[model samples]
Target: MAFLLLGFALVMVGASGIRPCNLAFGADQFNPNTKSGKRGINSFFNWYFFTLTFAVMVSLTAVVYVQSNVSWAIGLLIPAMIMLISCAFFFLGTNIYVKVKPEGSPLTSVVQVFVVAAKKRRLVLPEQPWLTLFNYMPPKSINSKRPYT
Candidate 1:
């Protein structure tokens, strides 16, 4: 009974941590999208998988096997500790990682999508040579279906 409850609690907490940390860790990679961001992204990918699997290995195998019993509270603490450490590392790495804007944030990707769409209406008005000044491709197949609408 105790073991089952412990497992359930761990599952809940572990899942919650995984979702946001996944984003936080993901953003940490491309902090600037430049040379430094490239290096940061590379390092984050290599280290992220290594630590993730290694932590999982220790939690499932070592925690259960080495701990030797489910009669005590220690079995549960392993995951709690994992959460603690994972979250701690998230904050610890924040200065190094790119920041993840919250969902619905103006900085989010959808904001730029709106900007692009709003601007597209004007893109078609310019003549071919003038449109070329912005490096935008003139819409092809103009006679086929008038895609701009």
Candidate 2:
């Protein structure tokens, strides 16, 4: 049982990175801003996580059955096949996945927002009490209200 649990942990952690990327890509196929598209995306996820849970349950059942009645290799391979099938589906549907044009620029965009706001001397900057106590204020009117700050 310890070995089985440790194996489960390993599989989960290994799968964690790919799960978000796949779900977001799949859901991206729908433009949730529209009513129909929103409904379609909602349907996609309803099927998505349900299928995920169903697969897990089926795999667990296979493992238990294998442990009890079948040869170890045969039992393990059943769920292994399921994983292979799931991977194939993902690959086959890859072309339909939603993609980002800016290509992983979210952080860059966020930082730029702050930089642009800070550059425009038009907002209230957050005050550092230490600076005020030490009399370290800059000469110009401190307009440093950055949302990212």
Candidate 3:
């Protein structure tokens, strides 16, 4: 019973960590503003869910069949081997992945925005873009089409 509880706790922790990160990592692959980027993200989500559903179906049927017909040990071994192979493939593709650094808690930043807005409510905003309180660089400054002078 203790071992079963421990396994459940570990699975919960792993799922909690991965669930929040997977969507952000996948979405980071394309810029959200551009047409192509929008399409890319949309297609990515569609395919991602489809693949997940398919994998779950396959794993359920295969694992159950193996456990019932062959041996419980071999059934468990199959998933362990698959996880090892998947991890290897993930590490191999690390160089090709777009890595995003962890910014401080997103909730903190959102609260900060609200606080800043309230504090600055009386102050008139500047007409000049550079003088604005919020530091946002225009897309033209970053995009490749318009090279910086």
Candidate 4:
């Protein structure tokens, strides 16, 4: 029973981690600026959802039936084998995929903004609003020794 619960928890965690990354990764494949890119993105999402729904429906109906009526071992093995094949295909196409390098955590910037706002909360505004505003500057490269302003 404990092992079963642990398996469920692991599955929940894995699914949660994969769901956002999968959607973002798929959407990142297309540039939505051009007309064809826009159409491609739309079509990609439509097909993605359609296939997802179909898989869920089939799994719930057919897989459940197999597990309940047929051999449970075979039913369980089916998804495991499918997942193995999926991973194999993904790794095989690694060279063709658009691999984006990881940027620093976005949450840090959000926290910094809130901290700065709290620190400056008591400050008086200048007569001219423009005087208080600063121009947007891009962050320096990762290799730079200088800290982000």
Which numbered prediction scores highest in TM-score against the true structure? 4
Question: Clash pairs of candidate 3?
Answer: none
lDDT of 4 at 141: 38
Q: Which parts of model 4 are misplaced by more than 4 Å?
A: 109-149
Task: List where candidate 2 sits over 4 angstroms from the true fold.
Answer: 1-13, 102-149
TM-score of each: 0.46, 0.57, 0.68, 0.69
lDDT of 2 at 17: 72
What are the C-alpha RMSDs, in order, of all predicted structures? Answer: 11.7, 11.2, 9.5, 8.1
What digit string (tens of lDDT, one per residue) describes model 4 on residues 1-149?
99999999999999998997887787767876888878988998999899999989989998899999999998998888989999999999888877566576777878978998999999987788675555534476343342322
Which of the predicted structures, 2 or 3, would earn the higher lDDT when compared with the native?
3
List, residue by residue over 1-79, the lDDT tens digit for candidate 2: 9999999999899889787776777776898779999899889999999988987897778688886797988887877
User: Candidate 1: minimum summed lDDT over ten consecutive residues — where?
Assistant: 140-149
Ranking by lDDT: 3, 4, 2, 1
Per lDDT, the best of the predicted structures is: 3
What C-alpha lDDT does candidate 2 achieve relative to the native structure?
0.76
How well does candidate 4 score on lDDT at residue 74?
A: 82
Better candidate by lDDT, 3 or 4: 3
Task: Summarize candidate 3's per-residue lDDT along 36-81 as a digit string, tens digits.
Answer: 9999999999998998898899789999899999999999999899
Candidate 3, lDDT over the whole model: 0.84
